[model samples]
Target: MKKTILAAMMFLLVIVPALSEETITVKGSDTMVILAQRWAEKYMQAHKDVVIQVTGGGSGTGISALINGTTDICNASRPMKPSERDKLKARYGSRGVEIKAAMDGLSVYVNESSPVTELSLQQLKGIYTGKITNWSEVGGPNARIILYGRENNSGTYVYFKDNVLEGEDYVSSMQSLPGTAAVVNAVARDKNGIGYGGAAYGKGIRELKMKKDAASPAYPPTLENIRSGDYPVSRFLYLYVRNRPTGTLKEYIDWVLGDDGQKVVTEVGYFPIR
Candidate 1:
């Protein structure tokens, strides 16, 4: 009778784990959506019982999702505002907070064939704001500068305007793309067009040197400069979660900061903060 009861108890233990919760969700940061998707794919391989869902709309979308308790994590390409912090505090307490995930040098790019190589921060501001309408104004041939910029929803656009343009509005005639890669592709095809994005996405195009504080850094973007902080436009990437995360959400985030997860970040284009 004792042996039979013990055998029955072992049978229940085997079924409990199989029936436990088996899925996880993460959302945020349109800028990192591509990389996030790639990470999700690999994670789900060994963790077949755990499913990870990722989506990209914009940083605001991600933050809002976190506040509403609609997502496990909120990815952002920009730092949070004081007001945003207050909102999260209201909802989840001060302990609910933000994490730095990686670093990126925002890159200004033009068509590869563009004759111009380097540009000053002041020149970049003028060009983006329509003050310098002609390429010749900055030493290029006599051609109207075709501004291709990210939409207002993008964190990159907001950062550029606030940091480089001193909160100036973009030129009225600028073409706004939906995402970073879109801007890169658009500028690559138009000899007169110029756009900006994360340094990781600036391949096959020429980065416009942003001269800061009279310092002569490299003429364009390079991984080395980005890591060492010589690149002025560089900034940290973020992920916001409750200060004390729980469950699978915590597991996933902890993994991202670990060495193995950082390797994935390096493989995908962004610089690993590790």
Candidate 2:
């Protein structure tokens, strides 16, 4: 009887803390990971009892986690596909809730030293689709153009393919990286290399001024350009939940959409939804 009481005490000690603490798991978008971490850190500092865990594989990975009930939030650079929505409805009895967390002008990156400063939409599609393989073809030097891109499971990858490539496949020779940071690092080091990712990630690299076509004026991914629809590659960044948030989750989501959280979005180099 004494041993049974001891077992019961041990069980309470182990399970009570687990039940008392609240944890929010955010996973997905490599593009949004830095911003999400910042939000989590700031949120936790104010509410120490609530723990927020953030992870990045890719946007697609995060959506998969949401569908599978493995994560509380999925950060995605692109809107959820129709098939993903269907899966959420099948499991949760509702289409997943989407929160617009930020805006990003999907930027094209090149080494700062490269002279290729701007690209038209057609030129970009041609370069990425392998029809234009040399820098000289686009008015740069004689070097062969090297392409860096995100992997298949990335929402950035899907967005770029659908928007820039117009549903065409990427060039077979393009080097696929795991995340935007990797692509930025590659472009920073490789003078002839070009890559595409969130404008927020353009630190050591150059974010090209993009034109709708050769006939249009070129513009960088500035806030004004994006807001005015002058930036050709701008997109909304998102957080998707299995259902409409409630309890602690709803409170957290509300905070994120509030002023303080939107400020963090700009601080991390992405535009706010507002």
Residue 84 of model 1: what lDDT?
Answer: 77
lDDT of 1 by residue, 127-219 (tens): 888899998988888998998988877777778889989998998999988899999999989999999988768889988876675456544
Candidate 1 backbone collisions, by pair? 95-243, 96-243
Task: List ranges where model 2 is wrong by over 4 Å.
Answer: 1-19
- Work out the TM-score per prediction: 0.88, 0.93
- Candidate 2, residues 1-274, lDDT tens digits: the string is 9999999998888877668779999999998999999999999998866899999998989999999999999999999989989998999998999999899999999999999999999999999999999999998999999999999988899999999999998999999999899999999999999999988789988999999999999999999999899999999999999888998899899999999999999999999888
Look at candidate 2 and tell me the lDDT of residue 235. Answer: 95
Model 1, total clashes? 2
Which candidate leads in TM-score? 2
Top model by lDDT, which number? 2
Steric clash pairs (candidate 2): none
